[model samples]
Target: MNGVLAKYSLNTVCNEAGCPNKGECFTRGTATFLIMGKNCTRNCRFCKVAKAAPEELNPEEPLNIARAVREMNLRHTVITSVTRDDLPDGGAGHFASTIFEIRHLCPDVTIEVLIPDFQGDYVALKAVVDANPDIINHNVETVPGLYNAVRPMAVFERSLELLARVKERNGNLFTKSGFMVGLGEKEEDVIALLTALRNVGCDIITIGQYLQPSREHYEVVEYIHPGQFKKYEEIAQTMGFQYIASGPLVRSSYYAEDGFNYLKRANATAGGDV
Candidate 1:
């Protein structure tokens, strides 16, 4: 069913992170394929993706990803990847190419791209933004104070800039980002982070509880309750986000289809087509 994705010279965040929603997303005919090799060059605390030398980019990847997504019956698909800092363009070309191919394969499907920071490469970010996917998501995984501790190789401000630049480059493309709580970040810090993202004109926000994947990775500091998540949602909605997917289960793409539907409806209404 996912032959094209398997054959493509790519890997996905969904698989690397051990997401709980994978089975449901796959069964419901959706997947967030990772492109541009599985080896990430950066070393983030909470992530399990290998840190090593990445292989050469496969030119046929776009075609395979497109065909596989088509065969998978995806009405809404997400394409994300491990950070490939080894590449000159930070794998931005591959991300854009995959989006183009997926669009050609499933013209009716809404494609959301959970992209890398492109190493704060504005031109690289623009390249992907210029492709015009339905949504562009860059995750600022934690608060600033914890960013260096948790994501030493990743800059918190740079991630914010990526989201800001994407919106600047593609006003119509729904801009999204996420935060994983329970990594020792305080409630006030979380709110401030959310506020900063909103200030940058982010259209969508996902707030989820972080579950540490392995002993070698970051341990789960605290397990947040469902009620806390609801409160977060309320706060996020008030911050002017168009869509807020908040819950214990809400990873960036947990409710992949719902996000697409929300964006489509909002876009239609904005255009006075509703």
Candidate 2:
């Protein structure tokens, strides 16, 4: 995986965000492709990706990602990127290009894109929607209360609106959002967050513990147990989430293929679009 990614000069959130499952996923020949550039414009308190003035856009990145996907022989691929406020389109066009290249190179593979808020630019978001990926994910990252402390540059309501807009623009597209636990949020806060996501037509959710990336980053308020994760999973399931990935090490794209398959089955069973 390292050789392939290096050969293509591709980036991945699993490495940039310091995901715990990086080694395991890489060993299995899977990765969430990170596009646009490695430097993020926003300095989110909880994120580990470097914050700096990003370099010029790599025009060939889209094809490189497609080549890597084809070589990896992935049946399902998750693509994410750093927040590119520097770009006029917030890098939405680049995302579309990558999606189009993947479709052209590997027609049968399922593609999931975990995108940024595009700074609430609907036109930019629409560009990504027009590409028509199988799933569109925009993670809220944490409960509303933690926005100021953990995600100071982001708007909680705007994130929810982004997910809502994806469904409104294309009802057939599956929308997903995720948030972290152990951020000093109460149980009621978690329930409210889940309800809010569902209210906006979100179909899939991922809940995981917030492990501090470094001493300089946001401190871990607590270490949520497995039982608590299971409890949240049960609650989300009852709230009509087609699929939920809840565990200590479950990142937004973790076990994404399984979640995608489960959603397909659920939609088929309910006589909805697959």
Candidate 3:
């Protein structure tokens, strides 16, 4: 996995965050493409992307991603990137342009976009949605109490509202959100987070353990076990999430194609359009 990603010069949340699932995903011949630029404007304690001036937006990124999709022959794909707040459009237009290019090249593939909140700008969010991705995902990352320490630039309720807005605009689109669980969040707080997502119309939830990428990053308060993640899945099911993937190594885009598989199956069982 290490050797494979180096040559591609690709950006991935997995690599950027030191994701534990990297080896497994690479073996599966699946990869998440990070577009725009790697340098993020926001300095979150949990993220490892370098904080600096924005880099040049590669005009050929979409074409390169389309080429990778073809070479990987991926049946499903996840495309995500850093928070490019420096861009006037919040890089939403670039995100959509990549999606549409892939759609033209890979018509049968299921695509998922794990996106930023775009600073809660409705028009910025709408640009991505208008492209009609298979799933639109924006991670809540953590509960409200830890916002100042964990996600200073992002608002807790606003994150929920972003997912909610996706459903409000299109009921058929599957909405997903994820957050790390062990950064001082209580059991009650976890349940509350699940409830909030359901209340806001989120259909898929991913809960995973948080691992610090470097010594300077946010320390792991607790190493949650796989059992606890399973328990969270049980709770999420009760709270009405159609798809819940919770595990120590599960990422928001971790095995996301499987999530879409379950999504299609569930939709079919209910005689709903997929």
Candidate 3 at 272: error in angstroms? Answer: 0.6
- Residues 117-216, candidate 2, lDDT per residue (tens digit)? 9999999999999999999999999999999999999999999999999999999999999999998999999999999999999999999999999999
The number of clashing residue pairs in each candidate reads 2, 0, 0
Clashing pairs in 1: 11-34, 12-34
* lDDT of the structure predicted as candidate 2: 0.94
Task: Report per-prediction Cα RMSD to one decimal.
Answer: 1.8, 0.8, 1.6
TM-score for each prediction?
Answer: 0.94, 0.98, 0.95
Better of 1 and 2 by lDDT: 2
Candidate 3, residue 231: Cα displacement in angstroms equals: 1.7
RMSD of 1: 1.8
Error in Å for residue 55 of model 3? 0.8
Q: Write the per-residue lDDT of candidate 3 for residues 173-270, one digit (tens) a residue.
A: 89999999889999999998889899988999999888888889888999998888889999999888999999887889888999999989988999
Two-way TM-score contest, 2 vs 3, winner: 2
